[model samples]
Target: MDRNLAIEFVRATEAAAMASARLMGRGDERAAMAESILAMRSMIDSIECRAKVIIGEKGLFDGVSLEEGIEVGRGEGPELEIALNPLEGARVCSTGGYNALSLLAIAEKGSIFRPPAVYMDKIGVGPDARDVVDIRETPKENLTRLAEIKKCRVRDLTCVILNRPRHVNLIREVREAGARITLISDGDVAGAISTCMPDSGIDIIFGEGGAAEGVMAAAAIKCMGGGFQGIFRPKNKAEEKLLLARDIAPERVFDTEDLVDGDIVFAATGVTNGSFLNGVLFKPWGAVTHSIVMRSQSGTLRHIKAEHHFDRKPRY
Candidate 1:
């Protein structure tokens, strides 16, 4: 993929973020998601590339989506695979909560893992401790080993988990192991990404989240050379059927490299403020946006603060 596509991708995320920012606190996630998808699709369709959304967040917005395996872009440039989460945390965004984002990942054709959207049991950590943590080990054992590698006590470790009822035993084990927990309502991708960012103060992540989110998070981790491992968890017979129909193995552990292969580019624009990136800010002149774009081949990450003047620039 050409390096210039990184900036083009950010433009889509930025447009999605700006489009959804107005719907914050409106308690209408569907509307917010629809606006973001439409805005992003408009931008993506204009970009000069032949792309397929092999992995995407679908089923929201009354069947609106970038959609898995659906064609996007201008159909005139590089062949690419796109993984997208137009509004990562719509529930959080609707409630005016933390860590809402519009983000996507790109790779050459056949590089990204294609999975049916299902729950995935996962473990994530930074580059320093990436080699130490193991998904096959018990949570307490993993935490103990991670603490040893970090040269810190078990109590000093903080793990992120989704606040779901299914995590009851997992949460108990982490607490019993003497590690603190950060429970997030949604947006585990950001939570998982935090583990890879040293200043983020997040040591590791453990629990189940969306499979699409796992791939998106894994792409960022792969770019940073961090650690992430996941296995599919189908909740019901229908879900199991959907996964099995695609020839996906539930028992296989998907590491960062397995999730995203070859060189990759990822872009994100914050819709609401949280740990790493600031949310879009509306002003009299226009709006200010905070975004970041990264590439694995060159290991370059760029933080952009863009001021959009509506009078001069038009919104799609």
Candidate 2:
């Protein structure tokens, strides 16, 4: 993929964030998601690349074209695979909560992980704590090793996890292990990526989340030289069958490299305020967008804050 497309992709995220922020706190998740999909799809089609949707949304909020195998882009550049979530946390956005964003990952063919859309048991940590985490180990054991490496007490470590009933045991284990916890409402991609951010107050992430979002988070974490591991967790016999048919072993632990390794591009624009990125701010004249664009080949990450004029904005 062209390096210039990094910024171009950010444009798509920006457009999506801007469109969705319009309905923030409006209690209309589908409407906000619909606007985000349209805005993002338009920008993606304008890009000069042959993009395939390997892991994407389908049949919800009119995002049918984002389904797996659907081809996007202008059909003119490097053939790439796109794993996208135009609206990562629609419920969060509707409630005016945190970590709502528009995110996408672009990589070479066969680089992004795709596993039948089942939930993934994932562990994400920054580069410093990378060597200490094993999903198979107890949270106490991992946290102890991490604290020893960081030269901090066990109680000083902070872990992040999704606030779900399935995590009741996981949460209890972490608390018992003497590590603080930050339970987020949604946005697994952001939750995982937060561990890589120095000021996000997140040291590690452990829980089950969407496999597609795991791939996206792995892409971002790779760009930041972080550590990530995911194991396919099939919830039913049908999903296990899907994995078997694809030759994907449910026990296999996919590291960050296994998930996304080649030259990669990741872009995200915040839709609602959060620790990682600020939400879009609408002004009397127009709006302001905060976005981050990353490229793995050069390990370059750019934070872009742009001011948009209502009448002069480009094709949102």
Candidate 3:
């Protein structure tokens, strides 16, 4: 992939965020997601890559969906594999909550993992504690190890996890282990990536999330020199069969290399204010956006803040 495409990818995320930010607090998640997808797809169509969506809107059974293997872009640049979530947190956007964003990861063909939509057990940490935390370990044990690596007390460590019913035991154990917890509504990609930032105040990310998101988060973690590991937790026989047919062992742990390899590019634009980036701010004549673009080859991270004037340019 061309290094210049990093900024071009940010444009796609920015378009999605700008298009859906207007629907904030509307209490319509589906509409917000639909609008975001339309905006993201529109922007991607003009790019010069032969991109194929490995992870997208829906599954194979959906009548109308952007499932795996769908080709995108204008077919004039390098062939790429794309994993995207146009609206990372639809519920967060609809309710005007925090940590909602549009995100995507791109890599050379055959470099990105193509896992079926399934729950994955994931554990992520920053470079400081990367070698200490493990997904196969108990939550309490992992936190204790992380605190030791950071030279901090167990109580000083803050763990982030999704606030869901399935996490009741995980939360209880973390609390029992004497570590602080930051429970978020959605967007584990942001939660996982937060650990890599110096002042994000997130020491570690633990618990289950979408398999596709696991791959996307791994891409970012790899670029940040962090550590991430995921194990597939298939819910049914169909999912198990899919994994078996692909020769993916359900019990195997997938590290960053197993998820995404070679030079990779990741870009995200915030739709609602949160830890890592700010939400879009609409002005009288236009809107402002905050985005982050990173590349693995050069280990470069760029924070982009741009303003769009409606009067100066036509809306897509």
Candidate 4:
């Protein structure tokens, strides 16, 4: 893919963030998500690529989505696969919480993984600790190993995880192991990617989250030369049967390449401020957005702070 497309991708995320920022703290998650999806779809449709939604909001059985599998873009450029979470933390955005974002990942055709809408047990670490952590290991073991790789004590490492009932035991183990923890209400994709950022103050991410978000995080990790691993965690017998029918093994660990391969591009625009990126700031004249766009092919990372003048750019 042409490097210029990186900025074009950021536009899509920026549009979604700008549109949804108006509803911040409105206590309407679905409304915020709907506006974001529409804005993202509009901007993405104008891009010069033949794209398909490999990972998106709804499943095939749900019969609703941004319709996943529906082709996007202008139909005039390279064939691509997209994994999008237009409003990654809808609940957080609605309640004016942190780490809300509009994110997307793209790759050449057939390069992005299309995991089912099921839970996935995931573990992520930065490049420095990439070869040390393992999903098959217990939380304590992984933290001990990562601390060793970083040449620091376990107490100096900070792990991120979703604050949910399922993570009670994991949180306990991390605390017992003496590692600091950051419990987020949502947006694990941001949590996962934070491990790769030196300033993010996050060392690793451990927990189960949406498989789609896992794929998106894997793309970002790949661009950062970090490490990520996930195993299918079927919720029930029906889900387990579905996975088996699709020939997906529940115990199979999917590494970075298994999730996304070849040259990849990842972009994100923050809707609400958090550790990695700042939230959109609306102004009388326009709005300012903070975004990060990266490509694995060239290992280029760009942080874009853009000001959009509504009068001059009515489309925004």
Candidate 5:
């Protein structure tokens, strides 16, 4: 795949973010989501290249996706795998909350696993705890281990987890461990990315989320030299069967690099407030976008603060 694909993907995500941000805190969640999803899908369709969506929400065959697995490029280039979350936190956007984003990643096809879209249990850390965490350990145990590595008190550690039923026990464990807990309603991509950013007020991310997001988060982490581990969890027999159909084993573990390999680029535009990037800010002259674009090959991270002016209000 061409390195320039990242730039193109960034542009698409920025457009989607702008559209989604318009719906922020509006209560018309379905409309806001529709606007963002349509913008993203339309942008993807315009790419004249064979691109495979390795990790995404349900596609066309499921009746939810408008165009699923559509090929874009005709040239015989590297098989490209694209992973996307048109809006990572629709709830956040609808509520005018935080960390809703438009995200995308492109890599050499077959590098990313076509895992069933099931929940994934993961533990993530920054460079400080890369070699210290294990899945079998308790959240407290991991915190203590990390504190030992960083030579900080357990109270100094900040653990992040999604606010959900599955995480109640995990959050309690972290609290009992004396580490602070940062609970988020949605946006695991932002949560995972937070672990790698020193100023994100997040020391590590633990618990479960969309398996596809694990792959997308890994792509961003790979560019940042962060650490992440994910184990696919098939919730039921049907989902497990889907995994087998895809030739995925029941108990496989994937690291950051394993999720996204080869030369790749990951980009995200904030639809709502988030740690890595700010939410889109609209102005009279134009709309401002806060975007993060990174290239894994060169480990280049670019923070793009751009303003785009349109001839008129965006229709549809």
Candidate 6:
């Protein structure tokens, strides 16, 4: 994949987020997501690239329609595999809650890890703890160790996790361990990156989310110099076959670098308020998007606040 092709994908995501953020709290998430998906699709259609949806909300083989998939690169760019969560926190956007985002990650062909569409147990650590936190350890003990490593009070540490039943006990343990809790309705992608950005005020992320997202998060963490570890949790025999069919080893433990390698770029546009970035805001003049685009090879993380003028509608 041409490294520059990543920017085109980012632009398409920006367009999608702009269209989606307008629907927040409007009592229509599917419509909002559909609009975003369409906008993304249109944008991707304009790209000059060949890409595959290696890891996306839909199963791997299902191509994001001109109305689906996270909008990727120009139609004729690089032959890349994309992992996308078009609207990562649709519920949050619908309720005007928090942590909604339009996310996408691209890797050179065959670089993305393909796991069963199952749950993944993961632990994310911030720059403060660096190599100190380990997923193999008890979550409670890891919190304590992280606090010590960071030289901060346990209460000062913030743990982020998806607000789900599976995480209830983990939340309680983190709170009991004296770490602050920041539960998100969705968007573990943002939650994972938050730990690495001190400005985001999140110190760690623990618990489970989709296996594909775990790998995507791992990619970003690798670029940001954080720590992430995930173990895949296949739900059924079919999901198990999905992995085996791909020739994926069932017992592999995926670290950040394993998900994406070579020249890599990641961009996220916030759809609702969250730790890493504020959601998109539409103004009288145009639409504004808050995004963070990072490249692992260059160690560059650019916080971009971009505006697009939709002054004229395109003619079909």
lDDT of 6: 0.76
Candidate 6 per-residue lDDT over residues 224-259, each given as its tens digit: 878888877788999888878877677676777666
- TM-score of model 6 vs. true structure: 0.89
After best superposition, candidate 5 residue 119: deviation in angstroms? 0.5
**Local accuracy by lDDT, each model:** 0.90, 0.89, 0.90, 0.90, 0.81, 0.76
TM-score of each: 0.95, 0.97, 0.96, 0.96, 0.91, 0.89
Superposition TM-score, candidate 1 onto the true structure: 0.95
Q: Per-residue CA lDDT of candidate 3, range 27-55, in tens?
A: 99988888788888888988999999988
Q: Please provide, for model 4 over 1-316, each residue's C-alpha lDDT reduced to its tens digit, 9 standing for 90 to 100.
A: 8888888999999999998998999999988888888888889999999999888765332233466788889998989899998899999999999999999998889899877547899999999988888899998899999988999999999999999999999999999999999999999999998999999999999999998889999999999989999998888888888888878877999999999989999999999997889999999899999999999988888999999999897544
RMSD in angstroms, all models? 1.8, 1.4, 2.0, 2.2, 2.7, 3.2
Cα lDDT of candidate 2 equals: 0.89
Residue 163 miss distance in model 6 (angstroms) = 2.1
Q: How do the residues 1-316 of candidate 5 rate in per-residue lDDT, one tens digit apiece?
A: 5777777778878888998898899987777777777777767666655677767654342233523365544444556778888788888999999899999888876777666756899888888788899877778788889999989999998887889998878888888889998888889889888888888888899999988788888888888888888889988989988978878777777887667778778999998778889998988766889999988888888889978886564532
**Judged by TM-score relative to the true structure, which candidate is superior, 5 or 6?**
5
Per-residue error for 64 in candidate 2, Å, reads 6.5
**Residue 125 accuracy (lDDT) in model 3:** 95
Tell me the number of clashing residue pairs for each predicted model: 0, 0, 0, 0, 6, 10
| Candidate 6 or 5, higher lDDT | 5
Better of 4 and 6 by TM-score: 4
